[model samples]
Target: MKLPNPFRKREYQILTPATKVDDSILERPEFLPEEEVKRSGKKTAAKQKKGKQLEGLISYLRKPRAEEGYTVLIAACIAILFTVFAFFGMIQAAGEPSLTVSAAVMSAMLVSAYGIYLAVRALRDKEKDQLYTWVGLSLSSLVMVTWVIALLLGLTT
Candidate 1:
């Protein structure tokens, strides 16, 4: 005769890389779905961070694997560098810029071209996220527009 105990639990098995699991025995009807099959929904911390980093700046870069994201990313990198350079140049010059306004305008225009290029690529692809492309385009267009306006107003010769 056997008596049932409410507190009794099945033995726990820990699986490691070296552990051998029996495939045939796993087909038995006693196991739960979770026990029979592992889960795939888990994500690594690195992948989560990468996805966050790509969200606003270059989410579509993974899909087409095109040059648009690369170019835009490069331009953004250069812009950050230019900002640092401009800051130091201004400090060295005691508020008067060592680089002429015209030189700055030219660099801005060149970088702005990359933005337009990315936008056009996004639009023409017809298979990518269009809104992100347009947003990126507008940012570059604004830069070019501001430069043009500055040139027209004689703010930068």
Candidate 2:
């Protein structure tokens, strides 16, 4: 036993014989400190988000005509042609008069539906072509209502 003093020189007692420690772990980047690990995780997540945004923007720019209304226009044209065929068939029907009338009514309804589609698309994209948007909406609405009225009249007669 040693007598305790107010202070003594600091001494390290050997608890065990010295052994080799693997210093290779220190060179590994994964052995980062706690704060560095947290910061890296946040940075990686932010980078991923930025990459995804860039990918989306790149894909959008890749489209040939992102705002083309050609599909709606083609649908509208088909509806018009079908409507005319229906009328001609009904007026000069050699047989199946109802078929012609029904065809006409269906075509009219299709036109109305296409018009509504165009209108909604225009509004969604906030299109600068205001006149075209209004025309599509009004034309669809008018054609739809007119067909409905005609259908009722045809049934009554």
lDDT of 2 by residue, 1-157 (tens): 9888768886666886454542456533357676775865744655676799888664433333323245454555556666677767877876457765786768778776976777677666642444555555665666677677877987998
Top-lDDT candidate index: 2
User: Candidate 1's residue-wise lDDT over 67-144, tens digit each?
Assistant: 465566556455445445644665777856655643665776777777777667757776654555665677677776
Give the TM-score comparing model 1 with the true structure, all chains together.
0.43
Candidate 1 regions exceeding 4 Å error are 1-67, 73-97, 155-157
Please, what is the whole-model Cα lDDT of each candidate in the order they appear?
0.59, 0.63
Return the top candidate by TM-score.
2
10 residues in a row with least lDDT, candidate 1: 37-46
RMSD of each: 15.3, 16.9
